[model samples]
Structures are given as C-alpha cells and as structure tokens.
Target: SKFGTIYFWRVHYNDSSDHVNETFSFRPVQPGGGGGGMGGA
Candidate 1:
C-alpha cells in the first residue's frame, strides 16, 4: 500500500497479427487505517 499517493498501471495485449487489440489499466490498492502499515513490528 501507498501513502495516499496517486498510482497508475497499464497492460497491453496483442494478437499474432502484431496488432494491439486492447489496453488494460487500474490503480492497484489503497492504504489502511494506520496510513499504510505492514506486518506487526
């Protein structure tokens, strides 16, 4: 998770014809209540 920072990602797909058929994208995940805490320290 990130500290409320804007993140972007994308994935491209192509066929055997060497043509880009589609493009997929999304914003992975968000931080928790502790502002992005990890395993118990």
Candidate 2:
C-alpha cells in the first residue's frame, strides 16, 4: 500500500435464525494513514 491508496472491508454474520439479519460495513484507509473509516476524516 502506498500513500493516497484506498481499500474496503466488511464483515457478515452467518447464523441460522428464523429472521437472520446481518450488517456489513467498510472503512477505507488512506495508504500510510492510520485508523479505518471508523473515524477517519
């Protein structure tokens, strides 16, 4: 990864439920930058 680079990531829940629901999220990070989209500016 280099500066100015961008990336994406997400997570899912695989469970057996009558109303199975899951949420996916991603936080891109600037190459050489710290922290994910969690609180990136």
Best by TM-score: 1
lDDT of each: 0.26, 0.30
Cα lDDT tens digits for candidate 2, 1-41: 42322322222223223222321122234333344432442
Q: lDDT score, residue 2, model 1?
A: 35
RMSD of 1: 10.8
Which segments of model 2 are wrong by more than 4 Å?
A: 1-29, 35-39
Per-candidate TM-scores read: 0.15, 0.14
Per-residue C-alpha lDDT of model 1 across residues 1-40, encoded as one tens digit per residue: 4332223111222232333332112223223313243222
- What is the alpha-carbon lDDT of model 2 when measured against the actual structure? 0.30
